[model samples]
Target: MTNGARDENVTLEALCRGDVRTCARLLTRIERGEEAVIPLLQALYRAGGNGRVIGVTGPPGAGKSSLISCLIGAWRRRGLRVAVLAIDPSSPFTGGAVLGDRLRMVEHGCDDGVFIRSMASRGQLGGLARAAGDALTVLEAMPWDVILVETVGVGQNETDIMRHAAVVVLLQTPLGGDEVQAVKAGIIEIGDVYVVNKSDHPAADRTCRQLREMIARGSRLRPDRDWQPPVIKTQAHLGVGVAELVDAIDGCFAHQNADPEAARRYMSDRARHRIGEILRDRLDRRLRSGDEGWLEGSIEPVVSREKDPYTVVAEMLSRL
Candidate 1:
């Protein structure tokens, strides 16, 4: 039905008004890689900007899903409309997610004010799938008060989530001194708020102490900003500390709002990163499906070193 008729049934008005069925169908088209929705996406971009995008990221087994479930209940209690975009592991053949819609059922399944959807990571090394930005774009167009993005468990290599989230919450399982020392680099620096989940564990206090020391010692990704990432403890399954986490998230937003220059600085950086992400994705598709089979045809020359990778990149850039 979405072959060429971008406006066949779905309308921006419906999306902006938070029409569930219409937006779900539009999201389906986006996941299927339908180009017909491009025009609508462009239009949506101009009209959209109402939602607050918060990103939650952590390593596997950190209880990210459980924490998020608790978070949904908290937000709903405040009478806020919330949406979740959970990134799940993909089936190699079908690119279907292993987890997503099922995660939110117990707490928020029947709530009309809550909307949850999942996308497959499609073998991305990062937590997010390739279509994540587009999917997020769709959600931001809606009347959601808060949009939560939960990506697959990630590590040092996963920086994609930081680009999309206005505020980032990094979750940790209780770790020992060495374990905490090990995470002081890439992934840890991007956190706006740090959380030690499974706080009931014996090591939780130690973990929190280690994280605070690290945060105090480390230089942040946004060093010029005054917001110091707080390390809090939580047992998410028991609904412990979730409210504090929410408060921490709110504080981060307030921090941004109070400083227009800082907000603009971070947003400018995010915009640059967003542009690069889209450009890279488009160039990847071009190299994969563009005229006369580019990647396949050039493999032998590049592999044999008759042409170095730099030369090959130069040639490709010229074509682009």
Candidate 2:
């Protein structure tokens, strides 16, 4: 079938029943700024609160993927339909990653109960909050019980991941100096659960203790009666601590039940992010259509210090 016809069928199925492929196609259409997806996304928002989204994030090479694989296995054993959204880093040259997750998640490919979508970062720095929110709408509407969002490990972006996940698992290791800096970027402060991945390493105990100290400090700062974020050490490659991690996540879900405010914030953020995505797309389309020379013309002025980015944006908005 023609791509247009296929997408139309996709839209129909996605709206009527939980169709993963159709949802994927609609996501692509939305990503490409096709106007057809606007109503579909709106419908998804109207049918919100379908699934619990768990975000797994950490520094690069923290065994996050392995941990997620273990978690998926554990969740699947419970007969839960799982959807995994693994966001891989894009190469600066080819705009793709060397390590694509599709190769690793082979078990899901054949299982109708499992859905896996691998996303390229696409040069979106802090916009993961938007991509994940869109992905969740697509997955939640489908026949999935749990949605997992795996992020390309970075600092500020980690905080952005929490905005999308109902339970945010912050993974780290036993490194001393720069490691602390990476965690202090604020991911550590927001984790619903702390995971010291590669726990077989010699410094696992040290890392666990450091994370506990940090959590204690955070508790003092917040003074909330909520359960303290538990730090679990895990040898993900060997599947050790996977069960405990799952239990910890369950605890997060339980805690969230008691504190409805967390769910309120999740919904509130999702709504705000949806609005931001629409506005951003609108602005981008306007800028692209306005003038190819607009940016070229601004360069000389910027080099001469005659105008700053703020001034340029104001001028552009004024023209719009």
Candidate 3:
């Protein structure tokens, strides 16, 4: 083995032995795009199917963190080791997260049964998705029995989590407006289970009903599925209805894997995504450095509006 491989093996061995420091280091390396981590991922992937990956997505302040905390409690009761990849949106200007999603789960930070890592969007929507996968890979190398991905409640681009997770739980609040917005965002189709959180709120039932109606509409349009997504109500903080939510999550995983086509779509999306990410990184580097002659030439005219962006892009590609 090369020196890097030897070092990686040591790291992997430490991970398997439940060394949090080694695991954290490996995760950092993976985040930095260090190839030395590949062997570690390969080893973990080879050991395959070590954990159940659950994705929790919804609108902001929908109590997703509380629900996740409840779920972690549930899993912990079963004596399962859990890992959470909680993604927060980076500021458009500063690139730092506005709120620390991981901080909300600080109650479980010392559990030893749980590992929670806070991640920023990093300006790549796809990066959040891939980082979740990488985090899962590293956690899988350890003794984790379940992995949870908590995405920033921003609906757009967050669907990328569906590719990596075995089950997706869509959370929402009592606002009729948010339910309509969720439908418009196409989150309805991607959800395996729809959770109407904050059930103690007065509008919870109405929001639940609205989601059901939306599902009914989708059901009529897409009649091919044997199973339909179910809406469950919960007050996660009080732990009311958490059992049913867990059952729904289990059922969704069971149903999702039973369909080969669903698995195929996920695999295809993941494979294509990896390639696309590499190209995007390369292109971004090229553009930032002004290394490509075409981009260098097109910059001034496009900025000056002497040439439109569309024409400039076309000419640049043609030149390349």
Candidate 4:
């Protein structure tokens, strides 16, 4: 093997053996979408499927960072190594994270058992970075017990996290109107655990009541009569109700472990989604490399009504 390939294999081995620096470097390479990242990820993918991945998502101002901070503490107290991937909004000019969640979680910087990385959403509408799944694979190779993913706080389109995480925590506050509408729209269906954060507010009880009712109504529509999500109230900043939230998450994990079919289905879905993402990325790269000119030429005819977009796309695919 070549020197570079040998070096990569060494680094991959170190990463799997719990080398923190190597793990961080591999994650950074994945986030940058480096060409060499694919081989590294493939080598490490099978070593994963052991870590518990938890996704936390909510609208803006839901205090997700604080909640995650509390979770880290709780998990650490139980002697489990944890990794966090916090997806933040990208800066339009630089395509970097605008506000890194690491700042909120500074207290854990010195903790040896914790590893945290912040990723930019990079304009992905799903509230996750494009490389998030790949990053998770890398983290899973390391000796982590749990991996927490905190999304960019986009109100809608955050359901993409469901494809990667086994357990999803959807946070909502007592903001009343728009918040309730958001829950009704679709986010309520994806959660394994519903949390009414900032529960110290006067409307906390009402928010919990509304969420329970919606979950009850939604459960009836689901074909599978399993796993009724429990809504718990929490004042995250004050560290209240966090233990119960952890227990609920742990219970959900236990339930999934007890059902082998459900576990297999979740893993199968994640694999399918990962394959689709890889195919799409490859196609995009191929199109950018040599097909841009042809695409531009084709666009004008469609714009002038000479052809429809579907036909043009078909012709392009046939050429491929």
Best by TM-score: 4
Candidate 1 residue-wise lDDT at 125: 71
* Model 2 C-alpha lDDT versus the unseen true structure: 0.76
> By TM-score, how accurate is candidate 4?
0.94
Judging by TM-score, tell me the better candidate of 2 and 4. Answer: 4
Ranking by lDDT: 4, 1, 3, 2
Local distance difference test, each candidate = 0.83, 0.76, 0.76, 0.85
lDDT of 1 by residue, 1-320 (tens): 66445464348878988999988898888877777788888888777777889999988778888898888899999999999998888887786656743464477889999998877788887789888888888888899999999978886668789889999999988863465564557787778999999999998988888888777776554568788899989998899999899999999999999999988987898889878977887787676564556656777888888877887778877886
Measured with C-alpha atoms, the lDDT of residue 272 in candidate 1 is 93
Error of 4 at 268 (Å): 1.4
Superposition error at 52 for model 4 (Å)? 0.4
> Residues 161-279, candidate 3, lDDT per residue (tens digit)?
76677778888888747555646745657777899888888988888888888887777766656568899999987889899988888887778679989777766876676567557
lDDT score for residue 303 of model 4? 93
- Candidate 3 backbone collisions, by pair: none
Q: Which whole-number lDDT from 0 to 100 does residue 147 have in model 1?
A: 94
- In terms of TM-score, which candidate is stronger, 1 or 4? 4
Better of 3 and 4 by TM-score: 4
Segments in model 4 whose C-alpha atoms lie over 4 Å from true places = 92-96, 176-183
- Badly placed stretches (over 4 Å) of model 3 are 34-49, 126-130, 176-185, 260-265, 282-297, 305-320
Model 1 clash pairs are none
